[model samples]
Target: MSAEKIDLLNFLQAHPPFDQLPQQALEQAASNMDVAYYKAGSQIVELGQLLDTWHVIRSGSVEVYRRSGELYNRLSEGGYFGEVSLLQNRPSRFPVIALEDCLIYLLPKAVFSELFDSYEYFSDVVEVEDRSRLRHSVSQREDANQLMTASVKVLLTPNVLSITETATAHQAAIKMSENGISCLLITDLQSQICGIVTNTDLRDRLLTPGLALDTPVNQIMSPRVFSVEHNQQVFEAMLLMLRHNVHHLPVLKQGSAIGIITLPDIIRYETQNSLFVVSSIFKAQTLDELVSLKADVRACFVRMVREDANSRMIGGAMAVIGRSFKQRLLELGEAQLGPAPVEYCFVAMGSMAREEQLIVTDQDNAFIFDDNYQPSLHGEYFAQLGKFVCDGLAACGYSYCTGEIMASNPKWRQPLKVWQQYFSQWIDQPTPEFLLNAAIFFDLQPVYGKSGLVKQLNQLIRYKAKANSRFLACMARNAILRTPPLGFFREFVMEKDGKQSNSINIKRRGTAPLVDMIRVHALAIGSKAHNSFERLDDIIESKLLPNGRAEDLRDALELISIVRIKYQAQDLELENEPDNNIEPEALSAFERKNLKDAFQIVSDAQKFLRFKYQPGRAS
Candidate 1:
């Protein structure tokens, strides 16, 4: 082969759909390839122009435009065009323009057709009319389980049971026992599902605490009952149950609570699942038993990956497991150390709090004591409680936070007033170092104890953060510091100084920046949602992003998160420690393309952030 043909073959082998072609066919096409060059701003293919060959970008960039003259897609090196026109044997519908001086490879229609017909992988990527490349990425997974496809309404029973919000705990228990129900949905005067009281909640909140039987069930019920729409799939219902570890999910139809679904219903529908581990975790009676469940946790994580659970589903499940561990440990701590001298809330911050935790995370938590807390008198008890729970968590595989952000840290163990002040200082007089500590704090959730205290903190943050423009600017600036892993050439920029040099930390480079920038938008919109995905929903609804950017961010987050999740699952399968650092070389051609697209989205979002909040530059 000539040197030019050899170079063309090498470039084609590096790109997708082409990379999947057989070597012999690839070389054949490369040898017959025609080269074309276009100057910046020049039209490579105008609307309705006859295009008989497929164009692959070899260098520089190109912009594909719709007939309406709207920017459709911007493609860099290794990107492809002319496939739609070539496949259909029609004139160009979407015109193509050179965004910069460009070198391109054109393969004749016959050769493209031969490869497209012969190669299954080639057909998968090239057939964009049926399914998008992004959807193709996820659809490649096996989704055969009946539960995955069936609607939650299929399992719905008309035997709905609920109690008034004003009902007593004893009356609720009686109602549950008389009805042979394990849970009763608590409704208000408007007959709306306000909370849920379960057997476990009664055991933990009423029986264990020796609360008065006449006390209102609302005092013991979980106010944040995660319900599902009647039309959602069974898999979604199961995911919600696993995500929040809730046994009962009230099913709603047109905004009215109509029925409920349980874990057993799902288990009967699909037995080979990980949610059983959560039920077992609450059943553990000792620290050793809880710690031993770590293996089960790993198994569940692996099963989710093999079952083709998406990043959001897997992350939510793992986070719920993590929270269960914390909750069970707190129960044990109270059992061993006795009840607390004062009511306090044990808050899980960071990823666990955000509902985006993975199997490889460390503990990031804090304690919010009651405002009436007396340091000299009750300090020792709370201190010991923190140590007990934090130590137990480390035993169960959630290693201590290296930065000492755990509840055991004295710096984070403070009264409600102090926590409020902490937020005020962090926001009102934001500094680089303070912002680092404050990142996790902003995504806080109360896992145990007086949950009301955490609500107060969240309310404080929402009110304070939205009103403070300077603070938001500082946060936006801090968020922009963590750039995505894309280089000027659209290649992944890897770590320069580390043992894993030349590799990218998917968490820092991909997910972190995405989360941070989203947080700024969430703060700007005064959104109460904490999870990155939910925050994106709010940001989109608030109309805070340019057209298509919110969905771009969502897709980018899912792709990066799924990649991170799959790699971690791979580490578990290999019995090695799971981590976030991933070498680009290890990725498949398809994954590399998708990941690059995700990273580019992150980079675009960062640019938007800089432009949106240009603090110093903004007049």
Candidate 2:
């Protein structure tokens, strides 16, 4: 090959779709590739114009636009455009312009057609075009079959009614009749959610029992309340109701009930197989029963993967199952120990809180006792409760936190004031140890009990961490520790330990660093969102990062997460133990090539983190 063709071949081998092509095909492409340049702000392709070549950016940036002139996508070096038009042999569907002075490589229409027609990899890559993998992943989850795309708040009645748990059944029935509603949320004296009472409960526990109309509503109310977040999906609410076999479900936002949903509401929406798994979880009456249901959980996971659910949808569904396990465990715990002496919230931290949990994850949870809690008086009761839940979780496939972060650890089970002190100390002082603890503790959401305690703790971290420069600097420094798994020459960096040698722990190398850096940014921006994707939205809105960098980071995170999710799903499908470690050599050429690009994005984001925070160099 000539020197020019060699250079072109090297460039083609470094980018996607082309990188996956056979060596002979690549040489053919490089030999025929034509190069051209355009000045910054010059039009490369116009709307409705016929195109004979597929334009790929070899240098500089470009912007693709729709016919109506809305910004479609911003592309940097190695980003390709004009594939859609070339594929269809139609007019240029999206106009393209050079955002900066650009060097472009034109692949002839004949060669483009040959590669796309013969190679599935090329076809798939080109189909993404300006929409990119991020859009493709999201669209997969929001398709016609996925009910999780719509929010639960949409199904709620405009006006919801509530009655005190102390009120008589007659009073609740009268109110329900007057409002023409089927259910009423039962609240305690403090107006906190105590339970939910529905017409079914009245019919079964009151009318059919020949009980007096003046009986207390609590007598018939289901104390084990199953609720969904208003921000949660209609399908998720449906699943909760299915799991517990309850018709009335309370919708909560920020720990307070906002509305209620019923079975008919979800029937009008869509149904998924995952809901049936969740329903089965609540039906388990014993620890053995819960443990035996693990196979069904795996089945649900594999089914969703087969049905083409994206990482977000699968992760959200799995997180709900995990939380339901915790919820049911708590119910079992309460039943085993009877009523607790003091109120407390069982908080799930880390991946569970972020709603990105996969099948292979450890339990990271803590307890937040009420302010009035006295360890001297209530210590034993809480300890038993903690062990019951944690042990039950372990039995249900969630491994115990190796770091001992569970509530079973006495140090983690503390009163609200003590927990506040812990958060305050972690932020204000921020030693290496505290920063490590903060990483897990910072991303917490309550799974059961008085969740308001969790809300207060979250508010404390949001305001305090945002204002504390030293704390953020230390956090950024900690985040920079786990860099992406790519060597200086862009080769895969293999693990050196034990049986996993020569493999990469994707979580530790890819998702961890990305999530850690994003968390630092989210904290600095005072974003309360826990999931990395959600946090990126807040960061993007705040303009905390440079233009297009936020989206790049978001796309990078999503891609990396999807890779990890895919492997775990694969393991489950094969009936093997699910794991985070992945061998690059085991991946197909397409995946191996794209993984390197994703790792490079991680490296770039880490460099930005160091420069932005400056850590020790801040002075």
Candidate 3:
């Protein structure tokens, strides 16, 4: 073989399908292959063009398009195309254009056919459409573990036992004992599930407390039920349990209870140390004990990234650990300062509320007190409680919110009715100042205490925000304020000042803007989802975006997030303080190219936001 042929064979051995071929077949392919090149922005194949050659990328990149001109896929080195046209013996259905200067390898139609027919594995792998393959790659990257693929129903115990809310503790205990179960669900007068009682509750709230057995089970049962749909993934159940520190999760089918799953059910599938961190958080009795586990938290994050856990899984797990710290601190606060003077809910905002938190985060939280609160009698107690919890969180590595959005902020800590009024004003009469608050506070979730306080506030926001066009427009205007870090020529526009010069603030320029854009759509559609990806689902289902746009947004978000996450993990491994600023020179060729693509997607989404909302009309 000539040296040129030898180089072709070596390249073939490195890429897939060709790599899977036998030595003789590989030699045959290399002998028959032809080379071609195209300049940037050159068309490789036009729609309806007859094609008899299979094209593969040896270098540079190309963009594939559907019949309607929608971007189908972007292919770089080692990426193959033109197989679909050759396989069907029809004119090209999808067009292709070089995205950059390209060197292409062209396999003769006969050779391509011979390989496809002879090798079953090569044929099977080649047959998958590009878009389907991209979606699969994204999902498979994120959900590689069994806990992600298996449904909660796989571990559910059928025919969950229940008793009426009015039932006596003795009766509930008898039912649990008779059925040989450790827990029972408490129902309402109409048999609707209301609360749950377990052996732990019985031991702590009743037996150990020396309460009469005849006391109503409702008084002893945990009223806030955290549950999962029957078809939800086991990992989701694990996240729910970890987030709220609940033990039992009732599996429901179409709003009706079908079975129940316990912590053991999830433990059998979980392999990461995130659950261990959360468990340790709850077990810690002091602020120092919780502070001691901060290293454990970083280790868990690093382990997850090393294990190839997706960005969503990593973010969700970290958020759960953060919430666990808050819950434990609240417990310690109550113990130290005596019980709160009034019913209050400690609510997390921003990334924590969205379950998109990471190792580097600031605490953004607030308190919602009952309406009957008296400032003189209850103010001192909550103020002290807020200081204790916020200080504890800071000690655990969640820095205090520089914006003073913490529960300790006097303005943020307010009565439930006051919170409701605040949302109403923010939605009905949005000002620039209120719009800034909306960006942060809109994604609120209850971390501890009366969760219903936050729920009621959420209900009010959802009802009013959807109908208030002006507010949505203002939000859209705010969303576009921070555009993705891209120059006019699509190069990364890095920060210009300080030690971070020539680097991109990934959170400020990438994920945060994407999240802010998603939030605008979520509010417009009245979506209750707190997470950006979940809100995308709602947006997709609502047909709010043009065809294939939502999927593009999702892919962009995932790529940007994983890159940011990997950067943070690397920082922790090096014993350096983690941050969001990313230097383009530090990234691999693939990362730099794909990040540019992702940033362009963000830019396009912002344009659509401006067009759809007419932000200029907000005033």
Candidate 4:
């Protein structure tokens, strides 16, 4: 082979379909490949054009548009196009344009057909829809870990044992013993599972406290029952158990208890280091003790990444761990400062609220006081409480919010009425400043205290923000301000002035922009969901975007988040401080290509957002 053909073969071997091909087939395909180039904004294949050669993007990017001129897809380096038209032996249905100056590999019709006819996997991939292809790529990344794929049903113990809430504690214990179970579900008179009592509960609530055996099981049981749907992933069940510090989770199917899963059940599937870290966090008594677990937190993060946990699972687990820290710190704070002066809700904002937190995150929190709260009287207590929580969070791995959006800032700490008014004002009159605040504050979830306070605030946001077109438009504008770090020619545009010069802050440019865009859609659709992936589900159901757009955004967010997470894990492995900034050279060939595709999706989503919410348009 000539040097050029050899390079082509190597490039093809690194990418999919071709990568799946046998070596002989791959070399033949590469040798027969003819090269073409297109200038930026130039059309490669017009709609209805007769197509023969299958075009693969060797470098640069292209935009594929439907017959109606709507964007169908974006293909970056290692991405291929023209297979659809060629396979059908028909005119091009989707037009292809160079998104940037491009290097294209043109596989002859004969070679392309031969490969497709001979290889089932290659044909299967090439023939799948774009969203399916993206999902396949994501699934491929996670396929190595059974925890990602295995359902909670697999871990459930047979014949879930239960006792009526009216049953005595002795009866519950006897039932558990008879069934060889550690826990028994407590059901109400309607036969609906209501609570759970474990051997530990039996020991602590009955044996240690010397409660009468005739006491109602309801009195001894944990009223707040945490559970999993039978079909949920095992990791989700693990997270629920870790988040709530529960030992047993009743696995329900269609509102009926089928079986139960325990901590030991999850441990059988994978390492329980994250669960242990959370357990330790809740067990820690002092700020110093909580601070000491920072290393454990990092180790947990690294382990999750190494284990092939997807971005959502890892993020949810980390957020649970983070909330544990806050919860433990609040317990300690109350010990020193006494009970709260008034009912208040400690709210986590941004990534934590979204359950998309990573190891390298800052604390974004606030307090919502009851409307009846008297600031003059209650102010000192909350101020101390806020300082205690924020300082403690900083002592742990979560640094203080750079913008001072923490509870420590009195601006963020406010009464429930004031919080509602704040949301109303931000929605009704969204200046650039308020829009910035909305981006962070809108994704709020209560971590502790009177959660009703936060609920009122969230209800106000969902009701007002969705109905206000001006606010949504302004938010859409703010969302696009930080564009993906892609230059005109589809190359990475790095940060030039920071200490981490020539690197990209993946969170800032990649995931954050995607989140910002998704948040706009979520607010526009009145979605109550906080997490980006869940919001996408709501958005998709609402049919707010063009077909496949929400899925594209989802794939983009997941890809970008995982890349950012993996980079942080790499940093931790090297014993260096983890940060969001990622050097382009540090990414593998596969990562760089997929990241470019993901970034392009973000850029496109931003454009659609701008078009969908024109500033002057009515709601």
**Cα deviation in Å at residue 469, candidate 2?**
0.6
Evaluate residue 83 in candidate 1 and report its C-alpha lDDT on the 0 to 100 scale. 82
> Per-residue lDDT tens digits of candidate 4, residues 335-399?
99999888888889889999999998999999898887898998999899899999989989789
Q: Model 3 lDDT vs. the true structure?
A: 0.88
Query: Per-residue lDDT of 1-619 in model 2, one digit per residue for the tens?
Result: 5788888888888998788788888987887789999998899999999999988889888878878775566677788888777767799978889877899999899998898888776775666443333343355342234464456755777577888988999999999999999988889999988888888999999999899999999999888888876656666777777787888888875577777888976764332357776787788898898898787777667656654566777778889999999999888888888998888999999998998888899999988999999989999999998999899899889999999999899999999999999999999888888999999999999999999999999999999999988889999999988988899899999999799899999999999998899999999999989988899999999999999888888777777888888888888867789899999888865467668878898899889999999887423
TM-score of each: 0.61, 0.63, 0.65, 0.61
Best by TM-score: 3
In order, what lDDT does every prediction score? 0.84, 0.84, 0.88, 0.85
Error of 4 at 513 (Å): 0.8
| Model 1 per-residue lDDT tens digits across residues 30-135 | 8778989999889999999988888988888888887887556667888888888887888988899997799998889888888888876677566632233233
- 2 against 4, candidate with superior lDDT: 4
Clashes of each: 0, 1, 0, 0
Question: What ranges in model 4 sit over 4 Å off?
Answer: 1-272, 616-619
Q: What is the lDDT of residue 580 in candidate 1?
A: 93
- Candidate 2 regions off by >4 Å? 1-272, 617-619
lDDT of 3 by residue, 251-318 (tens): 98657899999997677435347776788888998889999998888877886776556788888989
